[model samples]
Target: MIVETFNKEKRNSKTVELVCDLGITGGGTAGVCAAITAARKGTKVVLIQDRPVLGGNASSEVRLWILGATSHMGNNNRWSREGGVIDEILVENLYRNPEGNAVIFDTVLLEKVLNEENITLLLNTSVYDVTKSGDTKIESLKAFNPQNSTEYIVKAPLFCDASGDGIVAFKAGASFRMGAEPKEEFGELFAPDKSYGELLGHSMYFYSKNTDKPVKFKAPEFALKDIKQIPRYKAIGKDDKGCRFWWFEYGGRHDTIHDTEHIKYELWKVIYGVWDYIKNSGEFDDVDNMTLEWVGTIPGKRESRRFEGLYMMTQQDVINQQQFDDVIAHGGWAIDLHPADGVYSKLSACTQWHSKGVYQIPYRSFVSKDIDNLFLAGRIISATHVAFGSTRVMATTGLCAQAVGMAAALCTEKGMNPADILKNRSIETLQNELNIVGQSIPNIPINSKSNLISEAAMEVSSELEISEIPFDGDWFRLNISAAQLLPFKANQNYNFQLLVKADEATELEIQLRTSEKSKNYTPELILEKQTFSLNEGEQHINVEFLKGTPNNQYAFVSFLSNDKVSLKTSDKRYSGILSVFNGVNKAVSNNGKQVPPTDIGVDEFEFWTPHRRPDGKNIAMKIYPAIQSFGSDNIGNGYVRPWGEVNAWVADLNDKNPSLKVEWDEVKKVSEIKLFLDPDYDHPMESTLMGHPEEVVPFCMRNYKIKDLDGNMLHSVEGNYQTINVFKPEKPLNLKGFIVEAEHPSEDVPAAIFEILCQ
Candidate 1:
């Protein structure tokens, strides 16, 4: 290398220009999903991220767990996991990095983006300037990367702003709000007042490791000396690390965007001081071997600038579970808001109010009101401050961003603006495109007109007629009330027999309950209650309900808690079957039930949540007059996942070779076939810190093969663990029918499929 001679004047940085179909600012989960979805739709995308990694708050630098409607399986939302590319990412992460290492998760996000040919990822690049076309649309963006000392000018027809602070939109003169609105502004009764704080704050977390030998820690001069300043300092323990310190926050009282550095420094002081206390406070035992392993350099920001769009989501929209004609996304995370003073305030750190079910997010909330070619995404989407509390979570925002990405692709193909896609019948086209890729919209069925499978006749080897759950697993004590969720039809008398062992003679009360809403699993409406006297030894107890169900929905066969009784649990697991408990999951519900204050404008209901794998076994029981809901015809029902009913067709456990045959009247040219399999939507599959029990969900199909009418094998797959599997033959085949042969993931678990589509 040759050194250049000193010049009288400094030289400017090198400039580069790029052109693409879609340009996205921010590489958070939202931006990442937008990039992936748009790329898959044949749109050229340029993703610019200021951070070195892709996941934003979910990245290694921040290390926050990715959660969505399922809310870590702590709420009543059943099968409510966000679908589409975000679901694929979470499922893949669970299969590959079940331990949830933050660094490993970073690799997963990077690999997904890299695998897409149409995505051009530009990391460590920050957009600082925007060039406007006539003051209504963005013509191009000016960005810089200090690492490479290069300036970038990116031009695209359409742009999406998923950056947490709305950097691009802000520079482009797009309207935005940064603080809470008055109650009268949106009729939000739960809106916070001035004393309670308007904006949420930033948080920082650190990880610790235990060494076999003793370790020493010394605080720096700038470290906080008085740990008692934090009211909840006593809650910290040897195991308190990572997201457990999510409440280690500050800086809501100041500017969240411009004062980020000042906030980060204060967080560091708090972290170092807490570490120093853990090592030297002499208030606990056996912490001498603990040492600080990693500390976050940047703070995870919660609230920032929210851009205004055509429609602004309000508090009533979330609390009422409002539906929209142009619904594109859904969110179920509670209306969680933090105190303005953050860790310093004694006001419980955060307040969360949950709705009865998931709410729909409309496409109108994604298009910028002023910028013709700009789309809003992530936490920056148009939403009142009250509603933003729920939509700001990583998974929810990522899902909304997926809609933005798909809209961008549609805009590029049709040569229209973001707002035009919502006009005429184009919104339906957008929804259909999203559903084709596995995006679950509330109350919206997959109505793809090109799915030729809907015109064919289907026959299966055997359909599972659920009559019994054999006593083949462990005996779980009735320390907490437990219930088995069973799908039932209307006007059908139900009788259940459960095997239980009682320490002493006791009266076991069994209640049949169902949710007021068909699609929910809250178990609020009690249908029938029966009391049965049990003997001292193992015995079978029978309970009969002649009233039956009011509608076709899931009924809970609830066994109230009895310390003297233990119920047998079955190892058998099904796609839409689960056993829930009337217990508290402090993460979502403070108590076993949510009994909110009278004026909070939130519903009060009991949280019936399921336990994770290897623990939440189904209650061993037998039902009279077996329920026949699973049939081969369900494969073309247009629903991809369980909504108010079991939309999947499950094969009988006894059927050794389960196969499905789809036949048509005449041979048709087919090029693509898509199969929707069971991936256990109830599981949250948190991306980091919270490790999963299994690499693959128990309901996933392990192996499968496809064949034509002439018995020629088209494609075969082994060890499949994904939700949606696609098979494309080498060339289009003229076939009158096709057969699918699948192997169950396990012997006890039957093979189940949601839908099959052919084109």
Candidate 2:
């Protein structure tokens, strides 16, 4: 039920019910990315998120310099500048904070909100409840802020839960999984048996400018008394980068939930104790200007909950670099594991080799198994302990946010669920969009038609294990759920159980049906919707949607709760849908096609009108009369076509008789003027720009008041073809190059692109 709504007309407005469009939760990495993604797609959106500041970990809060995909020439950056909004923020940060320090990021986040008019930001707020009618749709969501104690009931057809913890999804009845599976299951060399729940530890980030500076302080009584019990107590004299750091830490067993407060209490003690040790040991005799400037208020947790999504990704999928039409992202980091006690444990399973390789993360990782509206990002995405180790990096998580954001916006524009988008429409659109932003979804073929997952592909053999996957090959490129490719042996096959989860719990029944009904086996599995007493953090869980059967379609995954959550899921979600490749099915390149070209036509009339400024306001524009002969061979059409001159004119309340006559001399205030020549009329010959006179420059057109009735003038600018930026007149302008600013922006930040002084 889509209603139409627009900005009401001033005081005298008409009653119009606009359909709620898009709703987003969280203002962190994923949340902001999703909002920008949707807004870029021309969707009007309401971006609701917690925290007054954005850029969760990559922000001033944690003060971690963002690491791109891969560093070129060992610089630690992989040309990830294509993420339009994200890069825009980074560039702005560099300008405002030339040093790009972690203490300030206000300028970065604010620039995006101001640039995109389609996005409405609701910061310092959290989504409390999600309302949904059934599996197919969302009604509205309720939000709350301590300052504004009043809970806001925001209504939007499309809702994106980018909260790192998957809170909305958990509240919406999403299903999820956790811990590591047995090595025999996924056959991932790193996976271990049983669920230790010991995951990657959280980081209490801090920045120190001087390493040689030392200060005097007393050790804490508690740490000194309990120093013997602290695990891995050996002081790491140097970190990975050779800085004197401490791998010596603990918190999980104590209380990871209240980590911030606990860390502050313990860190202060450690700081004093360290000074005493160094001072007493005479390591720092005469050091100065060095101090723990600040420590993170909040510890960035690497792992917590794992949602059960449509498909569970695994290390095998990554190891093989399996090609999937539904590939949402790619990760190259090894599975990094943290000890259960928030300390560096010896029980690790990450291999450094994978860092240089490419692996595909399918689109299934976005949604929760049971939670309907919820999506997730950061280290908390859906993956087994080992797999999570690989996918839990900031780079991949950012990609995940981008994927879900596009899907959520699509759900709003097209009255359908996100899963439906994957089931019905082509996944290629999402991939292409990501590519446009310069993300590398390596599996995306060149110009393929529809990038979608295969219907149903069971391993079929108990002995079908594959080890080495091609990083840039096409023949063996395939897309299968992590469950379908797990427990890899030289030869073996593994089946999967269809499951689901959601924000709230409700009765969800599932059944496997044959494509034609003439089947010897088909039974429905009536799954009971199980609800958990979800807390305010991340809680989305993943569940299998189907048992071991075939011919499954429309597997439902949803929750039942507007304020809390509700969900429904079926085992058999889809079957038998093949993706259409551009020319040859897989990625066999259409460039091989032979061409038969003949004579092309000429004097073609291409009618097109430039849209008004994207800022939603019209510009102060003017049109000039074309002083041309009756019939000239529009010879060099490399000029801006002039309006008037034997052309039809449309005006707003000015004249009954319009003419295309120009004065003998009119100063040219406006440089370029465009006209629309529809082919529906006669296709005229080439238009011309004619002039002949010593000082009578016929090319200079007149300035005839380019204004609206209300009298507003627009600043007209011409951008350089190379760099798509409007050239500022007073400042040096160049389209050829741009500045590669620091990680953050500031008022005195130097430009990344060199300036081109226009003579």
Candidate 3:
């Protein structure tokens, strides 16, 4: 069906020319996200992946667990799951592949891409050549597929180098820097004093399976003579996998790209050596039955060449929690940097610094300065070494892909380049488009067009007047006070009540305050304070907001600790809320002496922690405003998951037929309807040490009915268990009102609907 010509050197000479709107190289996390996003937006996309499978490092070969804003549930960073496409993938995985199976996850990624009819996916195709029409424009790209021995030429208006190493940019003559930059170069506080070509290296991981009989591991000829060479080798267990061994690194002192083969060779030695030590060295004789099940042939890479862009993100931008006007994405991961020498270094494997909260990643970072139509996503995007340490993560980079993919679609529609979009002040349009697709941009509210419920009057059956939901999870401790952000008006005095349980008669202190600095969530100014003496058992206690409360926004109401008492919290955590906990770090430079005994668990506790406890146990507290459950404002707020407060349309548990009826002021034509249901965010859908949790969350609505006025059933959706559900009528529905009823809502708990959308 296809023909090819060979040159004098026997290389393929003929080219299969294909034209598309966007040509994306690489099939890694960022690349796949970019291709899928662009294709879904009606752009013709060409996704060229050099590997046989998608998901790059997350594929079965590498097997790295995807992590982003949540930062692996680290200290103080909670309720930060990445939104948009990543969230969709996670929710889907939770429903379909709860076992954390890599092969299944790969199929999910592949199906998402293939389902988009506008995408032309080419697997095992490597783009090795580029043609530049002028000094700044990319004319076309040349690629080869060894499996089929085919040579192809792809021409597109826009090209994205999602390739982890920036190969496309390198071939197109775009400026890029490899390895670490000097501290003085970008004024980066975490940069090395002297610039070096060394980079964070390549690593390989293997999986072990237990057998009924003892299995022997013979040392390969090239295996390391002594496993003690790695100081942290004692932590290795038979149950551990490659992901748990984040420090199994090598080849930072050498070229990570050009010498990949050499690096892979050395990694093999260590991987086998570690196994031999466990089985043969008498160090882990308990692993006598454990044998190697799977070994990674392709080493997962961390850092490589970083391309230059209009703006080079620096450490200051991250530490300051800068909010750029053109921000299209955000990152909450810590600035985790590994030594150039990696595992071979005498010092620890990594050094990390956390931000107060999620920080903005501007759109300027993805646009190339030298190339007119060239865009860079993934690890190659422009950023200082320290900043890259955080942005290089898969989830953050996937957000960048969504930004770039949306930008590329806009450029095609507007007949402009990346620079022109900025010049025309169309960045807001791009951001709005992103937000419409459920991407959360910090400080940017939802576009007014998609918020249809703003005008409708909402009704609920009843409210949780006195009873409180318990927020008990492993992440929450009895000693810490968890604060929920409740909405309050400026300069208004009000009464706030808390439903709490106590093991014995105890004293509790509550404080009303605001964030000391604009960037953090920790409470600072004490607007009102009160102490309560309570008896055992669950009871309601009232605290009053006297005066001087800031204008309408979230108020941080903190419930201080009584060791015998525990505040009832929702099992699920929400955003715009925070908790105070005891910290493990007691270093002097951390200003441990100055922090309030309760708030030191967070990165910026010192600025507000004035009260100290002699026992050194940080004061634990839960902060929130008065409960406004079942209020009319619940459905209008642009929050789906309960953050500081439970913002949702709820019906009383005792109601036999609870429903939320919304009547617009005038009859309107609706083409689409969407409902966001609560999936119990507290029960995370993640791959853990014990594998995946329950695939289906109990809180998700299983059966619901949609109807119009006069009790006319328009549609009935049953056995529904997704976080988000969409319905489109064959023709526009001319109606003045509609009612949503949860036929079989979760028992005992009130039926809840997060948001109702109509357009």
Candidate 4:
């Protein structure tokens, strides 16, 4: 090969120009989702990431678990997991890597993006410059990949900045806020004061493993010499690894964006110093065989710049559970804020206050107010400092970014801007598109315009009639108050009979409670209360609520804690049915009840949460006039997930081959059908670090097939573990009706489906 050299000139790196329909920066959960969502809609997308891997904080580099509305299942937001592409990723991760190996998770994300033919992924590329078509519209972006020594000029009509710090928006001169607003500014009572710190900080984590033999460690000179310098040093132990060190934070008081390296160094010093104390300081025994297996070089950032959009979400929107007409997404993570002083300060690591239920996120909050073609996504979306505390979580931000993706696709198709879509009342069109892909918007039902099943006659092989949860020879101690959440129709009287054993003669308290808001799981309104006298032996106790339920919602049949009594639990598990406890989760709640100051403007209530499987069994009880919420008609009910009611169609436990048939008066051409199955939305499928107990959710259909009227198989799927299953024949099928047959994933759990759509 011959090499030619230029004389008296400075040569630039190789430059490549690419044009796409949608351009997204930062390949975190949000960017990954945005790219995938837009690509699936037939839009050409370019995904840019400065890091080698995707998932941002959830990547193996940083290794923070992906959590959203479910809030680690520590709050009352039941069945509130974020849906669409993120749900698919988390569910796939659980099936492929239940142990939650972060490296394996990286493969899952890469595989997902690679599977899409329309997405062009550019990794290790950093955006440094922006070219604008006008003062308010970005024309192109200039990014360089240091690893390849290449320069890229990416041009697109629409641009989304999910880059954590809003790099593109900032470079394009989009309006942004970097610090907290005062209390009087937005009337946010929970807004932090100047003394309390206005921003959350960066955190780093390290993992340790036993080497089977003694290992030696030496601290560098830069390592912190004194472990006592950390205020919470006493809380550290041999088992303190991974996210347990989330409190090992710093630099909130500093410029989070420009001073990230400084903050990272401080965190590293603290980490190494803590390790030194554990290895050489003799604070922990049997640690000689332990060694640091991995240390995150890049820190997981919590807060920085927030771009302003057409609408700014405030604390009131979250606390009041505001419903927006242009709703695009939902959030249920508590208003979690960390102290700015981080590990150095004596203040608690974080302050979290949960709302009664999930809140809607409007599409207006994702479009730039100044930039005509720009979209703000991820933690940088248009939410005030107070509201950002809850919306900043990865999964919540990912869902918001998904809305941006769909909006971009719509904007590209209609030749309109993001604001025009809202002004023209086209948000419903956007919402319907998202719902088609399995994204759950609060209070938004699946659109029936394209679903032919809505016009068909539906019949199921068998329906579950909830009459009893028979005793399975398992006894549960009444060490803590517990309640069974049961669905009831409006103006329906309910009678319950519970089996309990008493240690001695005592008074057992039973109460019927429900949330003031039907869609919420919080049990705050007590409709009826009764005190029953129990003898010294096992007996049946009857409690009746003659007033009946005020609305069609889940009512909590509550039994207060009494050490002298033990209740019976059943092994039978059903969809949309759960037993909750009035106790502390410690991770998300400090005590069993939240009694905040009156001036804080947040509600004070007790946390009623469900325990993880292998322990959270339903209470053994019988009800008069069994509730029939799981009817055959529910398959076309428009609602996909359980809202105020059990919107799923569950089959009887005795049906060996469960099936649903949708028949039309005349033959109709069907190109595709989508099935919305249950994937245990209540389970917080953390993408990393936290391991799952099952490879597939027990309530999901493991095997299913679609058949025509002549009993000919059209399609079949095995080992399915996803929430949304799409069945498309090689060619369009013309038929009068079709049958969907499915097998229960587990013998103990019955077959259930939320909604089915045919086109």
Candidate 5:
């Protein structure tokens, strides 16, 4: 429904309906990502930020360093590195001010929008009123700017509340909730047994440059009668790094956005008094002139309005790691709460869930329980007090907004409300989109009753591929275009190599090309070693892995290539989650390092392209790990290598037996090694299975054949069961390790499982 005249062409002879693909109110973490995502999808999007600049807490005032469940201890998650808006910021930081100490966060977002022709950004604007008809449709959203004293109405099929206060949801008559709930509601371990108004307090981040100098601070205007009783206010001697400042919570009584002026005033006094005490105390001995680092003029709020959605995620959902039928996001950060009327404290002990591995955030939480038309983003998504605490992190919030943007786009395309997309779009599809864009949805367990159309990284991107395709910008889709290489004939060796700029030890995407024809039957590349991670802007990781090949293939034949291969979980708790479900990259980076991240190990994998295909054309497929390296290895506890195809291939070695001769197909994978003593005991077929060890593990032999149900003998050498090019394929696939049935089904010594990327 969009009619466009190029900048030079004004051929609008006819009227065109400007269908807003997405209407995002509130330019915070969620709103920014949402708008950017929709714009990238070729949708006309309108972004409204009340502030002059974008970023709510992280920018407007620049809080710096985003927090996320993706590798906080030191590991970095490439998946969490969103494309669109978030990517723009990272790339800008990389070249403009790699140190990040002196970078303008708002400029980065502004640049991205200015460059994108589809997005219309409205700054210093607010959604004053919203109207909806029937149950699940938003008719118009009226935006007013006091600066210009103007008002404009926008009509969109979808609307998102990224205000962090659930502003749009509030005006749209959506169901919403505030404060904490009693323990009986969900019976979570950290519940209060009774409801209370306590929510996480807000903060203003400050950096310290004079760690060695003496700093001082005094009390504020607030009464301190029972200050000691306040849970988290204890100022341990070393509590105030560099200089100290206070930014407790407010807004419990009224609107947060409209009354931010009070917050700033309160912070200024709190800071001045705290500094007064320090300047006047003996604590000044170690310092010369106590310098005040920065104070948060813009507050970083922790709690706000939470809308009621189809599913209100509770602590139970987090505790049991419940699999949702419509998962759209994942969060692992602990639920962090602070007192509303207490001294220097956060209520982590009460509202927080023990950090197990990350869990999925449901799609049902995005829409409202009452006003079907309204969608929410950021900290305002549907959740019990405890649930919101876990997902309130900005990284996860960015994902929430990304999902909102995508869902809004879906609504416009199908002429439905976003709430319905929560149901209509299969959980698999939602999970796939998040994963393709690098958002975790690890809860699509096959064992659960939810949709089995399980989604992994739909089309894997990043270093997993053969070539790291460079873009003019930071945003790059985890996709490849092999058709562009069309007119390419079959049976040709179009090999490609992967090389990292080593500009910085950054987790990046590498893309190759492939078609959908050769997925289930291909051998993926494997890194021969592991990596030691470091964090100093950049490091050097030098290593390489050879490409793999499929078992058999004929020229001019069509095949399916795959985008991702699923990762298994490991056993061991880096966090509270089961060790098995952790990511592979984390294990690699943390493993086998003497000093760890200093003079570390390097794990490199480079897959090569095979020469031919069934149809006469060159074949190459993109490669990406099913899970981000931060995924579970599934091996659990420690490594338990699985039994591979028996080293032995079966054939009727009658030529050596003087009896009969037959060819055996090796395509059907084998898990155990079994040698028929050859009733006659003649030279046991030449292809005797050889493996890691004869007694400790199972190995394949060259001379063995499987009997099909039809009693027909299937040989390994004849290429019968199935053929795959272990080399490069055009289209990538979602692959797990081999699932083989051992000849001897023992209970304790189950078949050994090799890593998926390995043979």
Candidate 6:
């Protein structure tokens, strides 16, 4: 049903009531994701948003671009996209709004919620009151819409406060803390020595569009009079939009929740002032044709009331990259902190520190310690200000919301509180459920039970192989030795292929090493060593090694420094792989050199590094084995490219009929097939400082044909830019096995199948 009032307040007064399994306050990315997840899991859900549009911040009203783990493809951390629901949103947005249009993204988010049959979406409804059955639980949420003069009473078994500011939790008497915590409180070095009780602040962003003819902009009377007053004046440009004006922030020292109106006015003045300088201050004459397209009315918020939870994440936890046993979501963004002084600060508007790798967001972080039934997602989750800087990203929060929704689904099923699910060690079950639905957890692979490759005999025609190490037509000096972590089973035998470019014939030493489990997240103890002589120019070197099945899961292929030998480098960071620099754990560059922690974070960078180049370097190598040999693992085992490599079974275009064949011991009746193909997550879906938005995801399998072994064509599917493809038969096809073949495959990229899920 579409309900809108043209006037701001004059409309019919209506009262509406809804009852559901889960009631979610706020329609930010986190709330939308939670609603979508729980609804799809067969739980009745009600998603309430104050704005007429669904997306918070990301909606047209706020105009903040959605960013998460990728951190704008920051260094080393490629393929760090917050998978699951956010991935769906990003992928769909790429297809629908490749230009990154704010208005279009609004419809996309709206459609996502409205399409969910199990989700009752109430837009333009603000939660003004909460009805509590007891001190520990909320019975219902009472919301009112002034525009339509409608009152809403939402009753539910479980409630989620994804409200960014935690209004529901606050009203419910949930124990919460606002602003910066003292370093002693959490033993966090990054925290202030004394509690400021100050937040990161709210920001307003402006977008500009180009006109063919010259256009002029007149300064609004409220615009700041002097451009020199801005701190990062040089950083502002005509193309700035959304997060580009991150420095246009204020109201941190003030009560952000209560003082939002004042903050909004201040943000407006700063935004208009910046544009005025660009258009009229004689500094940017090139922008004569550009005019204001949009300016956010609602400031995108960073920190607010953080509800106390079983675990309060701190800077120490983020800095150490702590892996929690009860991890539900993970964050890779740097611990970014904007000074409470904001635009007025003489120092940089933001300061960032990187972690070695991604850190875990525990399930305990979302479950309220005081309110038994209240779950928190988004900025309102339990975290000190320093830690909140990292977890506050929409993508990370959305994943946490996914966890909450999944946990809520289980709660609805088992008739238990959110805390009971974790305290009972049912978190494993929850994790398994999350993994089954394609949510990525750090250090966790797909559940073995759901892995079809484990049960069936699997065969791949060929692994994607290239003769020369694919390079960007550039070479690096052999100053530091490098290695990449490759997954290895105890019993499997493997060899590596290198396309070494030597200036002269030289002997290069190679070693295979394993790590001390997942602790260091780097290569340790050399297992085997060998030396190979390479000729000038590009030469192939294959170092073969066989070992008895071992206990460790990862082995590194390390190369010793050989003078005049230049190794190939790739920007891509493959999953299950870590690189070494000069024998030290150098995969991540924590040189204390600051990079603008773009929306993704300083934890990720634009360039990967083989050596500590403060400028930036590629992290992974193209020098991998030609063909990998393993036992009895199906294509699904490799389907999830958790890191960077295309997790797929490839078939050469030279082959007569390129296909991946899977067979079982007996005739297995299958009705559905789920295929997760490569959508090239490495490509940017939206515009960034580095590049424009990618209109389409290249390298995806297209026009593929799935058939039975009897030469009968079961179905033909066109890969229409979808990452996950589900094919269901009108009736269950009684078949023993099937083959997916591409008659005319993608030319440059070989036909690859990540996984084929059959049930």
TM-score of each: 0.99, 0.53, 0.86, 0.99, 0.54, 0.82
Residue pairs with backbone atoms closer than 3 Å in model 4 (clashes): none
RMSD after Cα superposition, model 6: 6.2
Give one digit per residue, the lDDT tens place, for model 1 in 1-759: 999899999898999999999999999999999999999999999999999999999999999999989998888889999999999999899999999999999999999999999999899999999998787989999999999999999999999999999988999999999899999888889899989898999999999988999999989988889988999988888778899788998988999999999999999999999989989999879999999999999999999999899999998999889989999999999999889999889889888888888999999999999999999988999999999999999999899899999999999999999999878899999998898888988888778466898889898999998899888989999999999998888878888888999999998899999988888788999988989899999998887897777788888999999999999999898888889998888887546788888886888888888988879999998988787778887787788888888888899999999999999999989999999988888999999999899999889998999998788999899988899999887898899999999898789899999999899
Q: Which structure is stronger by TM-score: 5 or 6? A: 6
| Candidate 2, superposed: residue stretches over 4 Å from native | 1-20, 71-84, 91-98, 135-138, 193-197, 208-249, 252-281, 344-356, 443-759
**Where in model 3 is the C-alpha error above 4 Å?**
1-15, 75-78, 194-198, 450-452, 460-467, 470-514, 517-520, 523-603, 606-626, 634-647, 652-656, 679-690, 743-745
Instruction: Report the Cα lDDT for residue 543, model 2.
Output: 34
Candidate 3 structure quality by residue, lDDT tens digits, 1-759: 988686577554566889999999988889888888888789999999999999888777788777776654442333456667766776777777877877788888898888999999999899999999999999999999888888889999999999898899999999998877776777665675433234778878888889999887788899887877877777678678867776889988887889899999988888888888877876665787888998889999998899999999988788678879899988877677777766667666776666666789999999999999998999999998789988998888887898999999999998888877787679989987886666767767556577666777776555433233343432223464434444455565666555667788878887777654433444556777888888988777866667645555445666654567766544332222234432333211222212322321224442222111111121222334434454546676766654444566666556777777888889888887778776654333443222544566555677888889779998889877676788789999988988887753555355677777777
Once fitted onto the true fold, the runs of candidate 5 whose alpha carbons sit more than 4 angstroms away are: 1-19, 60-64, 74-98, 134-136, 193-197, 205-264, 342-352, 422-427, 443-759
- Worst lDDT run of 10 residues, candidate 6, spans 606-615
lDDT of each structure?
A: 0.91, 0.41, 0.72, 0.91, 0.44, 0.71
- Report the lDDT tens digits of candidate 5 across residue range 1-759: 998566875543222223476778877667878887777667788888878777786573645345455433312111222332353344344334433332355676677666778788888887778778766557878777777766767787667788887777887777777767776666655553222344655555444335565444544556233333435434523235311232344444334556567755654554454444444544545444456666656777767788888888987676445667777766655455444542333542222323333456778888777776677788898898877867887767876778777777666666777666656544455555443333324433222122111211111111111121221112111122111121112323333222213323324322222221221111122212223332333222332223222321111111122122111111111100010111122211222111212211211221112111111122222212211111122212111111011111111111221111111222322232211110100001101110111111111121223333243443233211111112222443223212211221122111121111211
**Steric collisions counted per model:** 0, 89, 22, 0, 112, 14
Point out the higher-scoring one by TM-score: 3 or 4: 4
Give the residue spans of candidate 1 off by over 4 A. Answer: 1-10
Ranking 2 against 6 by lDDT, winner: 6
Q: How far in Å is the alpha carbon of 417 misplaced in model 3? A: 1.6
> Would you give me the overall lDDT of model 4?
0.91
Q: How much lDDT does candidate 6 score?
A: 0.71
Candidate number with the higher TM-score (3 or 5): 3
